[model samples]
Target: MLRLASLKFGRLFRYGKLLFAASLLVVMLLNTHSLFSSFQRNELTDRRFLSLNKCPACFGSSWCRKFMNGQLSFEGWGRLRLLDFFNVKNVHFAQYGEPREGSRRVVLKRLGSNHELSELDQRICKRATGRPRCDLVQAMYKTDFARLNGDVRLLTPDVVEGWSDLVHCPSQRLLDRLVRRYAETKDSGSFLLRNLKDTERMQLLLTLAFNPEPLVLQSFPSDEGWPFAKYLGACGRMVAVNYVGEELWSYFNAPWEKRVDLAWQLMEIAEQLTNNDFEFALYLLDVSFDNFAVGPRDGKVIIVDAENVLVADKKN
Candidate 1:
């Protein structure tokens, strides 16, 4: 009876060892397969050459890089994230000339047609040739702004945050500076930003006088339909379009509807303050306030990203 029990016990121990070996082999094979797959994917994308000059915020750190590459889509916000990798803070509607790789080029192609963008929309579609195919989002407009010569002074990320925090209004000093500069340059007519459309061109010229900082605007010639230089003097007040360039709620808590409502409210305030017909513009796309080194233009709340204001006509 002892001999028989020993034989049974020996059989059970060998069986257990065999099962463990098989399980170990399976786990090793899975790990190898996973590693192989990752290597293959990396080879196909060839993202090694994509530099940080092309995107800083999204690709600045390894964490941002991995998260954006994996989770962010190749459309909408994803494309923006890719551009953010290069730290391009001011890819605005007025200043689009060359096509970017990935989804940004696709949106440019769509805008080239008259259905979404007007034929006269020379501001963005300045040079839409030789576009590349890349996985990115359709960028409408982008800009970065910072306070110059104030209590805050430096245009740090935190300072831009503080300016944007004031949902109902911007600093009175900033507003005054913009308006005063507009008055000085309304007649000069010529500025560094001759390519912008009517409203955008005027805004850029005004920005030059007030901020004197480099600003990117839409590309256009004088023959374009909208010529806003003549009507510059008849404006009052302004609304700083606080677009945070990310879908993060902390940058801008209000929805599109709320934002539009606020625009109207600001316009009313401008009318009451200046007692002039308050004209305003909306940079209704993702805009990075920190990207703009210059101050806001007074009197003219120009729509830097005019694409957001227009409703694309699918049927047309």
Candidate 2:
């Protein structure tokens, strides 16, 4: 009887050890799952917050207000919307005025990638009086537009030659045209002030100094029959433009006749841009089908991307 009792006790002890080990394993798995779930939640929250917060600084306050008020909303990238979290283009498509007037599709460009913008911000902060904590307004005020101003004097067009990253054509006439167009569209006093304020204007000047796309679009406005995207307006670092259409690559498998016509149109566009009446030749350094697009309705070929265009003084 003593031997039997001893053997039963040993069996019970081994069973208890096995049960405890199983319980510990289950607890560890559960804890790991909880931790993973928490991480996912935190990541999503951070992305959403960053997207909204960057709007005011990226698009300006007025446009930020429009976004907050639901006057503008993002449009999904079809089935690829799921991967939008990984988008690197810094460009967003949005619908404008779905309630009041007919809805219009527009492209909002951040003008630079995330890494590029971050570097730009760092440079701006370094130049600002506020140092490491400076905002765009402070940085804008710190910019010396006078030093970078192109000559505007009519009497002696060659006397005071100032250079700018905004225009590379080196023509006072082109500079004047750009300035006039910019003022008419962007800086028309109080009425325009409602959309873009003093801080925004300064920011725009800084952008022109950094990237010349805004100035280029204004210099060759779509309204003037230029094969460029329409310069709708800017909020901050972001600029809104009329969405032309899908990229040229999308039409690769199109009808043979259509393909021939598109190729012809592209050649014509290149010819026109190289030898136009503007007295300056625009050499497209990055001439790729991806940089151009076809109009959805008119089937017109347009240079949707002008970031890499170089202007040369033809007369010289």
Candidate 3:
């Protein structure tokens, strides 16, 4: 009887040991897989930056349209995560570019509206392209606000949250000094900014800027057809458009000289807007350093805000 009992006990112990070993093996496999996934995501992120920088045309309408149509990868070709937060912040490509959330592609801007950016971009993209592939969703992207042909990056208007934090609205005295210097200088290229303190400079800009948003307009002849109308009309759905540049704000480490040059351009642009040429040009009322940037050609300035631009007649 004793011998039989021992055999039964031995069998039970052996089975338990085997079950424990199997459980441990499963855990090890799972951990390894998890680590591998993390590594892959990181590697892809680095590769994406390289690919994006190398390809200036990546954000062009054709490319965006292709990507929208599923001919291009939603994850961005060559692991270029056009939708990555860091990439979107730095890409500097699309006319109406958006910043995306890291975990999922949560678009914060598109066409004209920002309230439902994630949904709007998705919807417009679907209408413009088609349904995104199920597999593509898993792929990552690196997107940014770079210039693309005539495409205007629509931004939805939202309240300026940090209004109270802006304790530095320029005083009349500061404005007088800055504007006087700007006006006195015969050459726009001269160091009009030489003597002003940082506060005076920014304050001067604030006074000139009037508001954070630009209420400007561009023309679209009805005879030319509905492309302008359709695009601009779509902008109405958005509350506002972005009127700032990543480089303008120095968020991307743009060179100080480049930044100052751009700033000088802002003051120059203001003077130009009042000239006869601006009589027909779009009145970029909110002419801040952030609202414009150097165009493809040297000394060319591009307007980043896609909406709120007014016609010359409207200003009249």
Whole-model lDDT per candidate: 0.28, 0.61, 0.32
For residues 142-175, write the lDDT of model 1, one tens digit per residue: 2221113123322222322222211113333333
From the highest lDDT down, the ranking of the candidates is 2, 3, 1
- Give one digit per residue, the lDDT tens place, for model 3 in 1-316: 9999999999999999999889867865767765455435533223232232222211111123222322212233323332243443231222232245222221112222223333433533354346532222211121121111113222111211222211123233222322343321233222334343332232223212222221122122212321111111111111122222233443246677766776676666555544533233334435454544444345445455423333333122
Q: Over the stretch 8-54, how does candidate 2's per-residue lDDT look in tens digits? A: 99999999999988986786576776545443442212324334343
Candidate 2 C-alpha error for residue 188, in Å:
4.4
TM-score of predicted structure 3 = 0.29
The candidate 2 region of ten consecutive residues with least summed lDDT is 147-156
Ranking by TM-score: 2, 3, 1
Q: What lDDT score goes with residue 78 in model 2?
A: 20
lDDT for 313 in candidate 1 is 17
The prediction achieving the highest lDDT against the true structure is 2
TM-score against native, each model = 0.17, 0.67, 0.29
